[model samples]
Target: MNTPHTAAPVARLAAATAAIAHQKRWFARMREEVAAGAPLALVNADAPQEILRAMGIPYVVNQWWASVVSAKRMGPAALDSVAARGYPDDSLQYDAIGLGSMDLPAADVPWGGLPRPDFVIAECGADATRKVFDLWAEHPGTEFFPFERSSATTAPDNWWEIVPREWERAYAEDRLDLMTSENWQLVDFLTERTGRSFDIDRLAEVMALVNEQAEWNRRTRDLLAATRPTPVSVNDSIPAVMIPQWHRGSVWGRDAARALFQEVEQAVRDSRAVCPGERVRLMWIGRGLWFDLGLYQRFQEKYGAVFVWSMYLAIAADGYARYGDDPMRALAARFTGFTDQLYTPPLSSQWYVKEARSHGVDAVVHLVADDVPGSAFTTEALEIAGIPVLEINADNADSRGGAAAALEAAIGDFLERRVLG
Candidate 1:
C-alpha cells in the first residue's frame, strides 16, 4: 500500500516520475492512497481523471458505472458497494450513488473485494449528472461538495439555439483552470529540479483539435445517416463507445470517426443493411438513453430504419476536425469555455440540423429540453428537409420525470403520422 513514488512528500521528484513509465506503478500509488482511507469521487465520463490524480485522491469513473446502474434500473445498488454512504435521492442517480459511496463507512454495493470510495464528486452539466452531484452533497460526513464548473461555459444564454457572441464572456467561470493552475504550481514547485515551464500548450492543442475532429465527426454522421450509405446500430456504435470518446477530442476522436466512416463506406459497398434507392434514414437527436437504452429500439428494428447519427458524436466529428496542425487556437475557438445553459446560439440547432441534412438523414428525433434555447430547432430543421420529424421530451436518463411516457407517445405518434404534420 506504500506508493514510495508519490509518497516521498517533496524530495523524490526525479525517482517518482522515472517510475511512472508503467501504468501499473501509478495504479499501485492510487491504491495505496485508497487503502489508507481516502474516499473516491466519481463525476462525468469526460471528466479529466488527471484532476483527481494531481490532487492525490482515489475515485471511480461514473459514466460506465452510471450506464451500468441505469441499464439495470438499480441505480442505488451500484454505489452501495463503493461508498455505502447514503445520499440525497431527489437528485441525479450519479450523485445518489456517489453520495452513497461516500457515506458508506465501508464498501457495501457489490464489486466484491474492490476498494470502496470515500467521497463523491457529481455534476449537473446535464440531468443525470445534476442528480449525481446533488445526492452526494446532502449527506453529512461524506466529502461531497458542489462541483463549481464541470463544463467550460455556464451562462445559460450560450446553451441555446443562438449562442450570442457577446455571451462568450461567460467562459470565465470554468474552475478547471484553478486545478490546472494548481497542477502547474506543483510543476513549478519541481521546476527547479526538473527545469521546465510546465508547458500547457499540449493541453491547449488538445482543445484546438476539437474543431477538425468535429468536422470529421459530422461527415461520418452524415454518411451513416444517408439513405443507403452506412447502416450502424444505435446499440452497437452510438451507445456503448463513441459517446465517451466524443468529449476527449482529437487524435483518438478523429481516428474513431475515421474508422467509423470507413466502416460505413464498407457497409454501403456490401449493400447489406442499407436498401438500394432506399426509404428512411433518420437522425436520433436528443440526450441518449441512460435508464433504458430501448428508447429507439422499436423504430430501429421494426421499421428497417437506419439511424446513422446522434448529436454529440456528430458534433465532435464535425466541430473538431478543423485544426490542421495547430490546435490550441482551435480549442480556444471551440470550447474556450462552455456550460450547459443550452438555450443560446451554441445550442446551434440550425448548424446541427443543416449538418444532419448534409449527411442525408431523412428525419430527426429531437428530444426537446424545455430549458435549451434552440432545442426546438432540431425538429424544425429536420422537417424542413422534407424528412419526417418528431419532437419528443424524454429525459435521457430520468425516465420517471417524463421520458417513459413521452417515449411511448412519441414512438406511437411517429409511427402513426409518419411525419410530424
Candidate 2:
C-alpha cells in the first residue's frame, strides 16, 4: 500500500507565494471594480477573460464556478450537472456545472449569491464542454460560442503529431478560427481595459512559483506515495488539487501543495496513518476527479493504496515557465504553445516514471482516451519498471460504468496478489 511515512526536506518554493498573499487585495480589488451595473459579461464554464475580450466586455472570472467544482465541494451537484448539461456520462470534466450555472441567469442566481455575470461565452474545446453552452441559450440567456474547432487541441504542438495538419485544417477552418487574426483581435480588445502592463517582475514571480510548485508537487506526491492510512481513500487529495484552478498561475497552488506535504509529514512522523505502512503506491495519470472525489477515497479505503501523483497539476508546474530577461514572451511561450499533458508520446510518461521512482510508487492507473496516443507504451514502461499498472477505460470525471468496478476489482486483485500471494 505504501512506505513508512518520512519527513521531507522542503525548500522555499518561491518568493511569489508571499507576494501573492500580500497582493490578494488586488484580486479582491479587481472584483470590486464590478458592481452589476458595470459593463460585464458571463460564460458558462468558458473562461470569461477570453470571451469578454472577444465581445469587448469587462467581467470577472467565474470564481464561484471554479470553486464548486473543486475537489472538496464536488458531490451530487457534480453528478446533476453532468447528466443535465448533456455531458457524456462517460466523459470527465468540470464545465457542466460551471456552464450549467450560467443557464440559471444573473437575475435568478444574483451577484450576491453567485456573482451574476453580464453575459455568457461558451467554447467547444472538449466535446463534453462544447455541449455545455448549447443548453445555455435554451435558458433564454444571451451567450456566444468560441472559435472552438481551431483551439480545442491546438495549444500543444504534440497534438499535430497524432492528428496531423488535415484534421487541424478541418477543425480550425470549419468551426473555429485559431489563426493569429483572432488572437491578435482578442489581445487588442482586452489589452486596453484589463490594463495588462508588461511586468517583468511579475513574470519572474510566476516563473519562480511554477518551479517551486513543481518541486513541492513532486515532494508531496512522493510523501503520499510513500505513506498511507489504515484505509486509503481518494478523498485524501481531493481538496488540495481540485478547487484551485484560479490559483494555477498564483502562489496558492504551491501553498496547497506545501500544506499537503506538511500534512503527510505529520502523519508519517506520528505513525498516525495506516496506508503509509502498507506496500501499495498508485499513480493517477491524466485528468483528475473534478466531479466525484469520493471515488478516490473509495479506492484508497479498499486497497490501502494511495494515489501520490497525477499529471494535470504535476505537468503544469513542470511544463510551465522559464527564467529569462524577457518574461512576458517566455510566459506566453509556456501557455500559447502546447505541451502534451494528455497524450502524444511516451516522453511525458518517461518523466512520470522518473517521478514514480523518486516517489517509490508501486503501480499506475492509466485512464486512456482517444484524444491521447501512445498511452499504452507508457503503461508498458511503468509496468516494466516493475510497477504493475491497471489500464482503465473511463473518463476522469464520469464513473457510471462497470469499467470502474472492474478496475477496482483488478486493483484489489493486483494488490492482493502482491501482499498475500
- Model 2 agreement with the true structure over 1-421: per-residue lDDT tens digits: 3434442322222332443353345345445665534444554322323223323344434433444434334323455555675555334344444544444434443332334443455434556455555544455534443534332333333332322122333123322333334434544444454555434364456556655665665565555555544222344443344333334445666676676566656555655543443446667776565445445545544565666566644553354433445433343333332333344344455666776786577777777754445688788777788877777665544444544566667667766775335
Off by over 4 Å in 2: 1-94, 104-186, 192-212, 218-234, 241-245, 249-276, 299-303, 336-339, 369-374, 399-410, 413-421
The residue-by-residue lDDT of candidate 1 on 1-421, one tens digit each, is 0011111111212211222222234346656766775555554543443334333345566554554445555544544443344433444444344334434333443332224444455333566555555554455544443333444444433232232223234345345354344334434443443233334555555544443445555565655555343444555555323442523434654455455556555554444452222345667776567676655545544564555566655554433332323332223323333323222343454456566666676667776643344665545655665777777654454445565666767665775577423
Tell me the TM-score of model 1: 0.61
Give the candidate number with the greatest lDDT.
Answer: 2
Q: Lowest summed lDDT over 10 consecutive residues: which window, candidate 1?
A: 1-10
Candidate-wise lDDT, in order? 0.46, 0.48
**Deviation in angstroms for 305 in model 1?**
3.3
Highest-scoring model, TM-score: 2
